[model samples]
Target: MDNTKIAVIGAGKIGGAIAIALKNNNLKVKATCRTEKRLKELKSLGLD
Candidate 1:
């Protein structure tokens, strides 16, 4: 089966939850957040 790539905007609670759920299902999750700080934080958490 082909892997699915999902993009979740915003790193807030809802967005984070969706990304986590999709990842748990073996799908690729990409999260976009406003501000470089938030993006850096997400990257540090290995959620690039």
Candidate 2:
């Protein structure tokens, strides 16, 4: 089966947690944040 690709616009705690959980379920995650700091933190959490 083809996996789903998701784009999360916010990298806040809730959003990040959702993205991570989706990824763990085999979905591809693309997280977008308002600031470089948040983006870096998301990246560190393994979101692309």
Best by TM-score: 2
Q: Residues 1-48, candidate 1, lDDT per residue (tens digit)?
A: 357788998977688777777777778789988788877776766677
Stretch of 10 with least lDDT, candidate 1: 38-47
TM-score of each: 0.67, 0.80
For residues 1-48, write the lDDT of model 2, one tens digit per residue: 366799988868898889989888888899987888988988887889
| Per-prediction backbone clash count | 0, 0
Tally clashes: model 1. Answer: 0
Clash pairs, candidate 2, are none
User: Every model's Cα RMSD, please?
Assistant: 1.9, 1.3
